[model samples]
Target: MRNVGVREISRRTGFSPATVSNALNNKRGVNKDTAETIRRMAKELGYERSEHLDHIRFVLARKTGKILDEGTFHPGVIEGVERVAAQLKLQTTFTTIELSNREAAAKQAFEITHDMSNGIVLLGTEMAEEDYVLFRDPQAPLVVVDGWSDRLFFESVVTQNENSAFRAVTYLAEHGHRQIGYIAGDYRIKNFPLRERGYRRAMREAGLTIDSKWRVVVGTTVNTSYDAMKEWLSANPPLPTAFFVENDIMALGCMRAMTEQGIRIPEDVSVVGFDDLPYASVCNPPLTTARIPNREMGEIATHRLMDQIREPRDYTCVTHLSTTFVERQSVKFLQS
Candidate 1:
């Protein structure tokens, strides 16, 4: 008899692979009929429960619990973390960091230290290294997501920011764009600072001068992006042929400002953005951006935390996820 694979099962049952996997694992969210069909296929394939799988299942069950809350970063990370935590028999809790006050955010994190469960995950763009150290201890295991701090000595998961930013800008430069402009977000955080460094490095490697009027560093909001772009455009008589935006949110604002003044993308101004957020593909001309593996990174972070908590190992690891350049309608190829 042929072995039943996830894809084969999905094709046969007309259900998604995720649904089939859920049913096979006895996870919630799949209907009874779907579950039965999945089991039947498994049985037909002579699938037998292995001891390793059972122990793995037991650990997973123990790891996932009631609620696993996360802060600041997108909830998509929480979903992946929860799934992995559930596999380990624990749940995840999510909360938002108060951006207005660092002390308030720190207090909230300290409060979570007293939760029913000991495991914690924190995600924040503005979280400092010192704040992370307070949350991390030998007894209580914590994972820092998307931020890097030298003061806090703990395991972390970071998005591949520098390389991704370099790729986006280099793509423009390679395609005959020398007089390039940059719309950057707040440089207070480590990642953005690294990205800024990457941008400067790219510009220097191409033998291009860094003009003050071409760089805009401001808050990570749409309004900030709009105002920054507007200021740059007004101050400079002629705009660059291409521009690189820090994030999708700001990219939207930059596009708005450009369009309002009758500037066209790829025609009058070529544009590329980081973070292929949900709205990136649906924008006016679609956004050419970098895609981050948010969910997978979250899942890996959870699993790493669980291992540290359970095994009490001496291995301290830092994981960096790579980003992909997604070609879309936003960028215009200028043949110069």
Candidate 2:
């Protein structure tokens, strides 16, 4: 006899694995009618979740699919969580919720946390402050990773975005580059805006006048951003001597666009990127980027979650980690 589980229930009912998991776990978003049907099918199949091992559930919430779907940082985060949870002998469950539909998303969250007894780690990558408020119930221990809620501070571990972006841009200034540009991504996330803020602040402090047209906004994914950058280049907008992109993925896209257009990097225009992802080092000219400790962030977040579970606290806190600036051959140092 085989052990029937969420997958079995999903296959029988023609529902997604996430929906089945949520329905079985007493989570919300499934209409009452749908829930009842799923529960009946689960019961008929004699589905039973393994209870021998303690479980760490992760709810990856996103306002849109662009950042969560395309970015590579989440794997490191999940890996960190797995490493820490494994040491404690707890199994893990991963689920994703889209916040584009705010009402439905809130309903889904409330249903889970209201009756939830276990600790859940939320991947708060593309979540906003209002979006954060939806999961503010104290019924369960919640830890956040890769993002933070400032007003309603939660137990979160996130890399420093604003400060890192500021440093990256300032470094360009130190290399005698005054006409610095910015490659902004259209991912509606907390980190993206923070990084742009850092870039703008650095420019101001460096006494560099930013031409509005020099800042180009592109899509989230590599292909999309590449095309968008190419389109921006076609518009014949004034180009800056250096560019600071929001993340490494977008940085690569913009670089590819420039490279294809017969523009030489460093020699023609210096570039700096954030999130020093794997391919950053391997890319031609190698990227000068701010390295985010994604794996460490995951490990720290899990340890923090364990602490929160063991010793429930009166108030929750957000943990901010600093980023390391990785220098490479991408940026050109002009003579002062």
Candidate 3:
């Protein structure tokens, strides 16, 4: 059997040399049907794709320190991405870009990634609306992970924030808690507003009165949340029987403050958190929270990027992965 070259494949498939090259190497810019046809013809003609086809770039548009945080959700997601890439025989290069200035960040990101790989997986949690526009017409196929932008259309994989928050609040209501409070995260993050909306909707549905004074907005980190909660608790405001926190880190911080003030968990005030992070299970009383499938979200995002690479198209829909409710000792069942 004779070895086939891209020229031969292109000649036989009646496609341009560039199109054949993109299709055979699994790069974007070719239509799905055409790419499939080229692959089939190339195989029939005994063509072997080059090793460069296996290259991919993972771009994290956040503070490098935050992405490297061992206790956060990003580590699990990165692990999942690496696992899937290995399974697919794809080589991945990880990089981080500071997103403080959208214009400068976009330019830097594009300069770093323009010709480096066949596709890109962008961790867009820190990216703003303008920052995403730079990648909208990317040189290679791109998939945004862990965030969504309403101003642009692109393939995205995000957690079911609204649905997960709804379930957590509903769970609290089912346990005979009518005054449900919310511990909100920074509204700047795209998912926080959705989670807050879900919390409000669930409270309304359960016929619970939402006391504005009980709702508190805190920073995204454990220390910040602890300080904020401590300050809020000093006011001696009427506390809700249960609180649904935006994430496990903040929930644990709030719990710490409550403990410091001699307030008991579940016995006095029940707490539920979103994103069942690793520490959630080992916290003082073990948190009752909604489990965001961080790893699975990463895996799905990688697969979606692969799909876009194989067939370049205008993909507009955002994919949302469902979250599971994790029952733990932190939340108590009140007498109806």
Candidate 4:
């Protein structure tokens, strides 16, 4: 007969308890050799395990239960979570929440912890302070991707928006472009604010003039951004040679607006965008944007949440991942 606890397995197999748990859970960060040895020992000891079903049963008994479904994914963020869940051989459940009312959304999120222990993933915008309060006791594991609350109330996996935006602007400046324009996202969102600050800081550092006409704050929707871009292009006679768009969605809108005006990308006006969504590569002239590690970010978020579930943390911790610049045909090199 074999012992089922992680400590017993660790002692029998000469592996750490963490390694034993990770191997049993099929999580990353454990050495293959160690995991294999632990598994072999379990098999030798006739330690019959009931597969993920047993774990699922345990999870279901928790007061905070969640279904990992399409409900959490918003637009570009869904594919990554779907891939991660598939890789984990987990069936996800989807639930929808309207962001306009934080209380309603929080209530829905709160109820998920009651009978589903699969954990919760927030794949859209960050949660509000009031919303975070709903999970103060955390009935189950919770992870936030591509966004963060005021504090690390829950585990988060997100790209470094501020640094990425800073680097994007620096790259443009290095390429000798000074007259830059910006189409920003909602100011209420923390990630967008960081990105805007990065863009402004980079511009000021380069000693370039940031024309008031060059900056526009568009709403969260792509259509909203498109209308704002069109208005700006129509109202201003002098358009900047280059533009920095907050996300690929907004960039698509700006692209349409610019094309209607008969401006060619990189030739008449250059553009850089964030998020590097799937369509970014297929754009007329592939967009030169910052690539986000969406899949890896999702996977990490899952693991982090699991960690919190296995061993509840005293406080929340934030993890910020970096982004890379993908040079495409969208931006033109302006030689001085």
Candidate 5:
């Protein structure tokens, strides 16, 4: 008969909990002979370190609650990470900090991580370049998701922001749409800018003139997007035949604003969005959008971080998972 857990082994070995943990994780500061003794005692006590460790610490960084709250893209990524970790018989834990105070958040994260024997997967969705620089180094191995930096590089896994946005916009062009507008959430994450770049590139490649007035930047949430779009519509500006919005939530809000103004979806303005959220399929008229493989990104980041933990890498790698363009009823075909 064998018991599972760390404290039991710690008590029997006459070692502090921290020493037991450090020895189990193969972390330094524990004397080599003492660590070996602890391991022997752990084995005798039937403490399965593989099941308890190979662990990862997930750090959710938030600049604001606007996008980091429940029911958003980040949760899917977390689920993916957890699912893979379980398959490997590894453990997962969480910590959160506010990027609103960059220095304090960075310092807090570093201090907390100092004692951790696990690698970290940072939720970089809302992180800016300056924030990235501030957290460029940590006491533990790190992987970042949904964000990247020109100045700093970590083993990163991100969505194919530019490719997906380009595909969405190009789909509109193929449907005989020359006048395509853009809608984006107002935020400081790296994803939005890449999505916008894809939109711009696609428009240019298609030889379609981008109407500067058609580009609207609104709040990151559905309510704020709705309010902003509604206010913009109140001005009675001419609407484009189609729009490629930043994400499904913002798309829904913009859709509501348009419908309220007597603008028929697909009929008046065909629209495409990114992130095929659950609501996309059930909406009044289904939204045609690019589905980001959020969970896959999270899983990959975990694996990558684990690899680094197993064998330290001198060079970092970045992985960008592509999206699936889901065609629904939101876009209407036209003839020139």
Candidate 6:
């Protein structure tokens, strides 16, 4: 069979040669969908996998239950990883780690990949400082997806949390909302703190008062967040004109709480959320949210891991992708 180069595939798919090469090599710069399309084209053209390429292992560290069960975020990211890996003609494996037993899990993960030349992609936003130490000196290359750490130096790909949150809050402010509240998630996740920081910064910029009563921290899940918001609403604390929630799931939960309390959405309390998950559009009042490119982040992280595997580097960097704002029915515009 004749070998089909990346350029031919790029021409066929309308992707750049670099993007096609990245997809074919299992590198991280291409989006999952584009990479998959390129891979299909390459396969049709008889592109073969190079024996020089190392296999990939995706290590999912879960603070909650399984990553798939947690929410649409992680699953979407995993889908991107799989699609890109398939295009690259690279072998991939998945392993789930319980955060409660991170030390043991990390050790086991290290042992499993110690002798192999495979690279690893660690997916989890809740990874603690100690959890990262286990993979610090793994003989194989590693990359982190949907999470970041200042303490560790692994190459990472994460959403632009701080800026995205700032934009979400600013959207509310622009709509004549000066009294904006925040529905936050557990701060243990690195992204949450960054988002909170952004929310605070935006509120300050808009000359809005940061009311402590309106800022509530709830568990990460939708159900837990719903219960927390319900309890918070019972106190009948002074409500803000608008709220910037950490994620769509939490936003949906808070909306449910508001409805149960007979508070009409957009009329009584306008709300905005982050991570425009699938349910964001289907909710009773479609969510106004900042869309995180989860799958794209996964694709880019995979490419970066491949680079690390090919060229072992002492220094590491984190890549942040920008978010887009999606306007929906959740936030009500007020007279300016």
Q: Model 4 reaches what TM-score against the true structure?
A: 0.73
lDDT of 3 at 89: 94
User: RMSD (Cα, Å) of candidate 4?
Assistant: 11.2
lDDT (Cα, tens digit) per residue for candidate 4, span 193-254? 78888899999999988898788776545566678778777865687889998777778877
Put down candidate 5 lDDT per residue, 105-215, tens digits, no spaces: 967665544433577788887787777765654446788888877797688888899988999999899889999999978874678888999999999999999989999
**lDDT against true structure, model 6:** 0.79
TM-score for all predictions? 0.72, 0.81, 0.81, 0.73, 0.82, 0.81
Cα distance off (Å), candidate 6, residue 271: 0.9
RMSD of each: 16.0, 7.9, 7.2, 11.2, 6.7, 12.4
| Best candidate according to TM-score | 5
Whole-model alpha-carbon lDDT for candidate 5:
0.82
- Give candidate 3 regions above 4 Å deviation: 1-52, 63-71, 101-104
How well does candidate 6 score on lDDT at residue 329?
92
Give the poorly placed runs of model 2, Cα more than 4 Å off. 1-53, 101-104, 115-117
Q: State the C-alpha lDDT per candidate.
A: 0.67, 0.82, 0.78, 0.68, 0.82, 0.79
Worst 10 residues of 1 by lDDT: 54-63
Indicate the worst ten consecutive residues by lDDT in candidate 5: 45-54
Clashes of 5: 0
**Top of the candidates by lDDT:** 5
**Native RMSD of candidate 6 (Å):** 12.4
- Candidate 1's C-alpha runs over 4 A off are 1-73, 97-108, 114-116
Residue-wise C-alpha lDDT for candidate 2, range 1-336, written one tens digit per residue: 346656577889999766776787676687888888899998898766433325777788977778767778888888988898889888878877788888888777865553334467789888878888888643456788987777776888887889999999999998899999888888667888888889889999999998887888998888889999999888666678899988888889999999988888989999899888899999988999999888888888888877875675667777889999999999999975
lDDT per residue as tens, model 6, 1-336: 665565577778999765776787677777999889988998899977443445777888876552235478877777788888988898878888776776677567656434235667888576766767666544456778877666767788888999999988888888899889888876457687889999999999999899997888876677888899998888888889999888887888889989999999989999899889999999979998999888987788788877865676668888989999999998899986
Clashing pairs in 5: none
Q: TM-score: which is higher, 2 or 4?
A: 2
